[model samples]
Structures are given as C-alpha cells and as structure tokens.
Target: MGFPRWSRLGSDLRRAPGRVRARVTTARGRGGPSRRRSRTSHADPPRGGSCRPGRVGSRPHLRRHPRGHRGGHLLSTARSGDSGGECPLHRAAGARDISRCATSPPRHREAGGVRSLVRQPSRAFVSVRRFIAFGVAIVVIFSTLTARLYDLEIVRGDYYHQLSEQNRIVRLPVPAERGGIVDRNGYVLARNIPGFAISVIPVDLSRTREDELSQRLAALLDLPSDAIGDVIRAQRIRNPYEPVRISKTPVPREIALVVTERAELFPGVRVDPESIRFYVDGTLYAPVIGYTGPITEQELAKLKDSGYLPDDDVGRTGIEDVYEQFLRGTYGWREIERDAAQREIKTLALQRATVGNTVSLTIDDRLQKLLDAELRKGVDEDKFTQAVGVAINPQNGEILAMVSIPGYDNNMFARGISTAELAALNADDRHPLVNKAIGDRYPAGSTFKMVTGLSALSAGTATRDTVVNVSASSFSVSGTTFYDWRAHGSLDFVHGFAHSSDIYFYTLAAGTPFAPNVHGVGPDAIAKYARMLGFGAPTGIDLPGEDGGIMPDPQWKIATFDEPWTIGNTYQEAIGQGFVAVTPLQLLNAYASVANGGTLWQPHLLKQVTDAAGKTLPIPQWTSQKLDMTQENLRLIREAARRVVTIGHAYMPNLKIPIAGKTGTAEFGASAGKDSAGRNKLGFHNWFVSFVPQADNTDPTAQIAMAIFTYDSSKSLCELCLNPAVGMTQRILEQYLGPNK
Candidate 1:
C-alpha cells in the first residue's frame, strides 16, 4: 500500500521547521468511567472543576447526554475501526466525538478495581480445583485400605487368626526340681527341704515409700543398707517392676518375724516357698558326695548361652555334677492372663512342669560310716597332715566306703558357706575340700608290685617259681643302689614278695631273662599293663574331677620331662617309682582285677535312673574285659600276697577271714624326722588292698578291698598307718564275711 494523504501531510509537517506540537492522554477511573484530556477542555473548564468525557475511543456511535438532569452514561468496549482500543461513550455521545476521549486522564480507581475483579475468580477457581483433586485422592486411598483389611481379616482368615492367637497366648518355662540323691540302702543322702524366702516386687512399692521401704527392709532383713538402696534405685532406673530376692532359705523364726512385721515395714515384701538342698548325713561323705550352690553370674552367662534360665540349679561336683542333666529335670510353663498394668489377673491356661529324676548310688551307708570312724581314728592317731582310705567291692568294682581326712561338714555348703567360714576351712594346712579317693594321685609304692607280677606273667617272661638269690639287702642297677626294707636270705618268688625283698625284684629286673632288655619291664610294657588295669585313664566313675592318674611312658617322658627313656627309668617304674603315679581309686580298681579272677569291670556310682512314675529307665550297660593270664600264676601271686598278712607277720594273723594284702612304704624326699625310737625314720605311704573269698571261684557278697595311706613326716621303718586298716579289716570281715576260709 500507498501512504494516505494525512500521513504524507504529517510527515511533511514533521520535516517543516518550527512545527506546533500536540499532546493527548487518556485516564480511566476504576471500572466506572474514563476521563478526557483535551486542549479545548483545559480552557473550557476552570481549575479544580470536573470535565466529562464526550467520547472514550474511536468508532463510537452514541450521543452525549446533557449535564445534570439525572442522565446515565453508557460505555462500550469495541474493536476500533482503525486500531484495537476500547471505545467508551456517554449515553448522548456520537461517533464523531469518540476520538476526543482517547486522550484522557489516568484513573487510579479503575486500575485497582480491574485488578481486584480479575483476581477474585482466579482465586475461586484455584480453590475449587484443589478441593476436587484432594477428594478424589482420599477416596481412592480409602478404597484400597478397606480392600486390604477385608483380605487380611476374612480372605486369609486362618493364617492371621493363628498369628493373633500366638500374640495372645504366651508360653513360659517352669524349671524342674533337682533329683534327690540317696545311698544304696535307700537312706537319703541329699533331699530338698521346703522353705520360704523374702522377695520384693519393685513395681508394687509406691514412689513416696521407696526409700523408706528400703531402709525398713535393711533393718529387718539385716541386709546391707547400701545394697538395699542400690537395689531400689536400680529397679526404678530399669523396669521398676521386676521382683528382687531379699533373702533366700529363711528359717521359720525369720519367716514368722517377717510375716508379723511386713505390713508395717514394707509394701512389696512377700514370702514364697523355695526349695533348699539338705545333706542328711552332714559330714559323713562330704568330699565324695560334694554339694551344690546357687548359680553364679559367670555360670549363668554360660548357661544362658546353653538355654538355661536364672532359676535353674546346677550340680558343682562329684556324682551331682556328673549327672546334672538327669538330675535337673525338664521345664514347662503356664499361660497367665494379666492386665495392661501387668497385674496377674488369672490363669488363662496352665501347663505343669516335669519333676527331676531320683538318683540311687552304689555306696553302702553302714560300711561307709564304719570306714569313716576307723579312718578318722587312724588320721587322728598319726596326726597326719592328710590321708585317704577307700574300700570297694572287688568283684563288681562297687565303692563300699571312701574316706578323706580333715573331713568337712557338707551342710556348710548345703546352704552356702560364708566367706569367713570358707576361709577358716581352707586356712587349716590339711585340705578339707580335696576328694582324695579319686582326686589324689600318689606313688602306689610296693602296692604296684601285683600289677608288675601280672604284666610279667602275661608277657610270659616270668613264672610263679621264679627265684632270685640275694647276697645282701641291696642290689645295684646302672650304678644306682636300690635297697629292700628288710634284709633277707635266698628267696623264691613267694618269699621274695612276702618279705618285700627289693634285691629279689631288682635282680629279676636285671637278671638273664630280663638282660635282653633289663629293667624287668620297660616304660612301654609297664604303661600297657597300667592301662590294662585302668590306670592312666578315667575309671568311668560317676563323679567329676576323678583324675586319670599318671602312667609314665617313653612319649610322656619326652613330652613332660624332656628326657629319654632309659634302663634306669624302666627299673624305677618296675618298682612303682619314677613317674608312675596312681589315685587310690585306681589302685583299688586294679586289686578288684585280681579279686574278680582277671575281669575288669567299669566302676560306677549311678546304679540306675528312673522316672517319676517309678518306671525304670534303660540301665547303662558296660562291657567287661578279662586280662589273659593263667589261673596258676594268679593263685601263686595271691598266695604270696596272703603270706604277707598271714604267716609272714603278726599283723596277718589278726585278719579274721582269709585276707591277702601287701604293705607299701615308698620313700619320697628326705628322711629327716624320727619316730619314738631314735632312728632314721623314712617317709612312707601305707596301703593294704584285699578281697574276701565267698566260694572257690565266686566273689563274696561284698568283696572288700581297702587302700589307706597315712602321711608320716617321721621316717619310721615300722609303718603305723597299717594298724587301722588291719584292725578295721578284721572287724569288718568278722562281722560280715564270717571266719577264715
């Protein structure tokens, strides 16, 4: 397009110099009306006066209304014929006057009014949209949750029902009572006595009374004041509800005192029955029987790992320790109903606990008592530092009676001993806690000669008629002089053992038959026979701490002594010295071998185990092995041992029945002390092992074998410890085994 004539004229005007300028402005007042600004209006209206608009924009076709006379103005928003501006007009204005209104004064009210109008609907729309969205989301979520609830409660009902039941029903364990221990004749050795103990439920104590209650309890129970305060403080810090044991195994007087004073002194104190272990025979078999005490913190830690509870009791030693599982019974539980506050309302369900089994030992009560009295006398007479005496049935390896010197009152341990009392017991030089029967390992002395003889006979290296001519009381081996206690003339094997001639055995250990590998039997052979006779190994006795006595061999010598096995070592072992050591029980078991005609039976204390209903459980069976040896050799050895007691010495004549025994006096350390007779007295261990014969081939009802040792600081060649064994043996045999064979 071509430029209009007006536009061309305007351009020429702009180009002309000194052209007159014209300005125009339009102003609207809120949404009400617009104001007009004109060059003519400035002259027409005086200052501070109002001027009405004739037209608002171009392309208006309305007439202007007369001023005053209640006339209304009409405004129209329209697209301009020449531009895109809104047209405004009065009710009387014409289109010719529309252009004059375009340049008007700005209306501040109109601008603010338009903004307010525009923002109102937008705010309402936003609010509505958000509300709808939130409603839809909430509905969807509600539907999903309801469907899941239906599925869990109804669709998979059984599975969830079981889960709910499990949450509601709680099962707890009920500890079993430990089995009672009794003697062979049905005398109660250990039994449980019922008693009441004071306990405090921490939660039941009111906060205001807590400290006061602790002080009162401390005074009443004779507990440490600090300890009582500590317990109360700890309970408050922790759960504040768990029960604390104030005192255990309280006596009847204490119980009665507590009952009378509990209401005034404490709010939580309660008396509950608790089982306490009792030793009926007191100190009779304290060492052998042992005792039990409360589970310790360290022991509790181990037991917890093994699934044991705090209330469980455990056997500490002896037979009780060996049979802990059988003696400690199974645990069961009852489901109890409680409120939200844990107040036990009632028993919702009940399950009873199974009681422990009762144990019957193989120990004889009467015989054990007899042996204890006599052995105690022997211990008293010598004023020995320590000693042990054990008597066993040789045929079956049943322990008849075992006694340890410096015996203790097991009742002290029954309820648990005080620190001062325990220290007092241990303070004495003589140990009372030691179970010497199975725990003490000492040199068997000449008592081991029978084992040597058996091994020689079994190896086919020597016979009963074997003889060794001795020129003197002493013999030299590898440049070391070994002497016999008694000086004797040329003696056969029988005379050699009867007189205990060291020269005869020393020659036998070094003679032609043994010269090939002198030292009668080397460490290897001696150890083999020792093991065969249940030495150097546990005897399988139902007791804890039964040591496997030392049976020195070449390997042991290298391992322990770091020394090589030599002929001297073999000779030392041949005469039961060197590194060879055996417990009193081991020696007794070995004698039983000879008494039972070469058969070795497993020695046991647990005779049988039974259930609560008296139905017997399966008895533990053991296999017996017979040592391969000729009866003729055994008979000759028996005769030689018998001669030591009968025709050989006056001590033998006093034995009522046909008793065979050998005394041992092995020297240890130095001989410094003297007996009543001023002579070089030697330190010695005394032993006498035997079995009474009932028939030609069978053992007596009770084949008695006694091994007793008296620690003599004096080096008296004449052994005095054997006196009691001889006296006790004679009395027992006469009373039980009748007269001579």
Candidate 2:
C-alpha cells in the first residue's frame, strides 16, 4: 500500500542519490518550444521537484519561499499549471500526480535556449510572514503608551492636582477691625463704628449678564456704570473669584439693603460691614489724633506684601500715622465651596479676625478742652489770629494738653473730604492744618535770653553780680547802634534778665567798649548754650511734622545770609533777637528742662498699648538728658525766672499758684504804620513761657511747664502791654488751678 513517503524520500528523490527535477510548463501547455514564455504567464511547476512512476510519495517536497517573491527558476514554486513536462508524473491513473503526463529534468530550452521563469509564491508563506511583522508593531506601540502613562501619573501628580483644586476653589479676604485710640483718662479720641460697603464677585456673574449687572448696581448706588464695569474688569484680570469693593468710602444703608434683598437683580453683589473712624471733638484734637483715608497707590505698592488689600484704609497723619503698625490688626478668611452656578454650597473653613490694639495717650482730655477754650477766647477777643499752647509734665515729657488755634475738624477727612473742601483747607491763609504747636517756627525773643544768661554765667563771662551800665535807650559798638526795648540805669545779671534788659545781656556777650574788666564771650558761647538747652532742634514729639528751629552762629550766619559775623550781631544774638528761631514745643520743652532743674525729656504722647487679648504692652520711655552745668547755677537761673513773674515787665504776680517764667516780645516784621521817629515800627510776636509751684522747682513739685505763643498782637491798639499770650496763659492757670470747676 505504500511507496516511500516524501518525508522518507532520500536526499534528491533517490534517483541514485541526486536531484532529478521534472519539467516546467506554461498555462497554454507549451513545453520546450522555440519561443520563450511571457513574464506574466501563469506557469506550472512540479512541487515534488521530481516525479516517479506509479507513486507520488517518493518525490522530494518543495520548501515555501521565505520572502514570498516571484519570478525565480522554474523548480522554485508549487503552482499547478501543468502545460509541459520532463519527468513522467505516474504511469498509472491512481497517482498523486494524477495526469499520466511525461516530465523531464529541470527544464531546458529544447528549441530556444534555457530562459528565466516566474514562480508564483505560496499563500501560506506570505500569510505567516505578515502575521509576525504585525505582531511586533502592536507590541512596540503598546509599550510606548504604557511608559508615558507611568510618568504622567506618578512623577508630577501633585503639581497637576493643585492646578485642578485651584480651579474649583475661590478665596475671599475678611477685613480686620482697626484699633481704637483713647486719652489718658480713657476718653475715646478715635474709635471704629459700624458702616456699610458694597462689593462684587466677578466669577459669580455670567459674561452675558456682566454689563447688565454693572448698570443695575450703578443705578442703585447712584454711581456711573462705566466705573463699576471698570472695577469688575480689573478684578477679573487679577482674580475672577476675589471680591472687589465698589468704593473705598462707605455706601448708604438703604442701597446696601436693596442689593441684599433683591438678589435676583444684582447677581454678584454683596453687602459687607466696614469699620469707619469716629473722632471725638474732632477740631479740638485734630493735630494730635489725625485722620484715616483710603490706602494710596504708592502706599499699596509698599504694603502689598504686608497683607494690605486694595480697599484698605490707612492712617494719613498725626498719631494715627505714627502707630499704624500697631493699630492695623491681622486679617482672617472664610472659605466656602461653590457649585457649577457659582452659588455658595457649603462652608469649608473659617478663620476669625483679630481686632486692633487700643492705644492710651498721655494727654488729658479735660486739660486739653480747658486749654482749647481759653486760647480760642483770648485770640478771638484780641487782634491775634494765630496761636499755640502746649503743656507738659517737665520731669517726664508727657504732654498734658496741647491746642493749635485755627485747627480743622479731622472728621472732615475721616468722612472723606471733597476736592473743593481739601482745596479750601490748602488755600486758607491762616493755615488751619499747620499744627503750630510743633510745625511752625518763630523767633525765641526773650525766652532765648535764658540760654544766653546761663551760657555767659557758665563760660566765665559773667557772675550773678556782673552788671553793665545803661546810659541811654541804645548801645553803640564799632559805629553800629542797637536799640533796646527799654533802658535801665545799671543792672546785674539776675535783675538784667528779670527786667529783660537788652544792653545788659548784650554787653555780657559782646563786652563794653570802655570797660576792660568785663570780658565778652560772643555768639559761640550763646550757640553752645542754646544747643545745650534743647534749642534749635525738634523736641522729638510723637506728632508728625515737627520742625527743627534755627540757631544762627558766625558759621550759620555766613551759610544762611552769606554775610560775615558782626559784634552788633553778637549783641542782638545775646538778646534772642538777631538770628534765632524755635517751635512752640521746643521752647516749652527747654523751659520745662530748666523748670525741672536742667533735665531735657523727649516729648511724647503715647503712654501704653492694650492688645485685643486684654494685655497691656510696654511703651518706649522718653529719652532724657541731665544738664552738664552745676545745680547751683540752675537755681540762680530759676530765681531770675521767678523774679520776672514778680517784678519784671509782665508783672503778673498773683494767679493762684506760685509761678516763675519769662515773657518775650520777639520783633518779626515792620508794622503797617511808622513810628514817631519816621522809622518802620517793628511787630512783636508775644510769648509766655512758664511753669507752676516754684518749690526750688524739682520734677515732682513743678507740675507743668507751658508755652503760649500768639502771632503779631502789635496793632496800635494792642502793643506789647496787651500781649494776648499773657492773658491767655493767665486765664488757663486760673481755670486749671482755682476750684477744679
């Protein structure tokens, strides 16, 4: 039943151990013809490379072409188009090579020479090759996708997660309540009161409804729609979720209610509670308490990192400006979740706000009121139009009471002053905002003589018994004549100062032309003592806008006036006349130093700070300097000051409490009229520098040192005798010391 199988066939179909291929043919059954077959013909080749008689199993099998290419030798393929032959297929009809056709060796050209043939590729070979290639491509694609997925999910997950959360969450700032200010006796100077504010959330408004909402808000709030739109647009660029306050100033309560109650009309509108400042007795304490206003663009740039919001209020001037860091409380926040429509859904977190600290000042409200009333009355009753009154505890420099006449109401600024109102304030000739107690400068007048007298005594120029003869109303030196306010026959140092004699102090500093024994120390000695006594500099009060007054020396005069020093200039400097200036506070502080027995204190108003937690914090101590001169010399000066109150030109010896002081009439400009001598008469700036309870005047016994200044009381009707400061100071002492009423 079996011939040898194809697998069992020998190496070359076993026709004597070598290949014996069959013949090849074309589809038209032509074989070994004279003409070559066309390249495109369907050719038949024997798959069993050789055929044997009567059996197919003994034939060697054909191997499929690995690359699936066609057109090779005729013995290469398995296509069956048996048109020609070489080896015989089978002699019997029952053979795998069914046709009993004759075949031959690998076909040769019987007519034409041997030619090339196209062998068709087998289907199995092409299919298996394509399958392997497709499998490799699929594996590479899947591997790349998997590696990218790993990097994205594991390497940078947190950064992307934060971005997603930021889109979903919106944060809003909750304003902290600003601090309060009170005087020493706990009377409120500046405190926060409840007010209303309007705000908009850009994220809550749909883009189509944005303009309509702005128009609605503008109509309700009585503001321009363009302004509201501008604000919303700006906020959208910054952060769409954060609320933008409509205006820095407070809105009306009725309007805020409309926005709240009619929520359907105003989509993103909110009514927020605002803190507004309430200044007690605004005008009376304007210079000390100051005022608050909206944070400016320049200030915002500097304060942005310090947690200041765009609509925040900041102190504008005075004490409010100085203590801003302590007064500005820390901010808080309330974060809530929102839905797709941007409506609040639930609370996520809450942080409560801190209230600002309470500041306690050294000022006494009662004494301030008393000084204010008296100073105003005296100035209004007389020709004087401007004045300053400041009282302090000489030992510690705690300001007791201070009043600058012609002061503006700080409440005007607190409530938001209009452009016209601010312009009016700036335009006022009398300068209502000047705070003359510390801001304005004036000549020292006779008050500076204390420095001169003390300097001469200290520098070996004179003693308590030193006297200079006064033969006339004027003194002449080197052909330059200087006139005194009045003349006396002969005066010692104490009486010279008590009488406020110009020639006596002048000859003490510039020396007598005829007397060789009396040596003069000149302007250097005067300037040294002036600087020694807290003159020519600011008293360093806690108030803003303090002016350091000028003290002229030979060098100072040359620098200021571009002129050389003169002996006459030295004589005038000795009288506190030629080139000297001092603020009311500086003069008060200096006299206070002398009254307290030669100790200068740094002037201040802040006494302590109380935080929100009910804890009191320590305040800085005012710097103090004890005098370099002997205590005995200070006592001698104090006796002269006492004698001025008793027997000097002011001659006001009975005011209830024992007083010692100097009275001054500083020459400023020429009067409108001329004197009897046809010269332009000088105008007098009256000043009263004094203190109370003379007990050799130690710190505890000398309760207060005060300076009263009135500008130009020298109309023909009110000369030096009618100096308004003298009456004002007298009235203040009487009311303060008399019955406690």
**CA error at residue 362 for candidate 2, angstroms:** 0.7
Which candidate achieves the best lDDT against the true structure? 2
Per-residue CA lDDT of candidate 2, range 1-741, in tens? Answer: 112223322222333222233332322233322222223333434342223212223444333321221333222222233233333222222233323222322222222222222244657778988999999989999999888877767887787778666655757678898899999989988887777888899888887888999898777665678989999999988878778888677764666688788999988877887767888798999998888889999999999999998888898899899999889998999887776555667778889889899999999888898889877876778657787889999878999989998899998787667566899999998899988999989888888888888887889888889877776778566788887666587888788888887777777887764335788888888888888888888888888999998888999888888999988788778877777888999989888887878898999999989999889987776799987887777878888887877787667755566677888888887575786789787777888898886454433358788899888766542465666676677777767776665
Compared with the true structure, the alpha-carbon lDDT of candidate 2 equals 0.74
The residue-by-residue lDDT of candidate 1 on 1-741, one tens digit each, is 121244433443354333223222343333444333324223222211122323335454433332321355544433223131233441224433332332221222122111100112345677999999999999999999999999998899899988766555556666566788888877888888875567677777877887787777666655566787677768667755557676533434455466556576778766767677778887787877787766778888977876577655677777667777677777778786555554556667767777778888888887777677766776677565666777777777777777887778877766656567899988976667778788878887777777777777677666666666566666566677766666666677777787766666655553522223333544566678879888898787767778888898889989997888877666667677778788888888887777767878778777777778887777677556787667677677777777777655325554446777776666665575766788665576666666666543333233777777655523455554444455556665566556342
Local error of candidate 2 at residue 218 (angstroms) = 8.9
Model 2 residue 656 CA deviation (Å) reads 0.8
Give the per-residue Cα lDDT of candidate 2 at 734.
Answer: 69
Candidate 1's C-alpha runs over 4 A off are: 1-175, 206-234, 246-267, 296-307, 425-429, 477-479, 512-519, 670-682, 695-702, 720-724, 739-741
Model 1 is weakest, by summed lDDT over 10 consecutive residues, at: 110-119
TM-score of each: 0.71, 0.74
Which window of ten consecutive residues has the lowest lDDT sum in model 2? 105-114
Cα deviation at 334, candidate 1, in Å, is 3.7
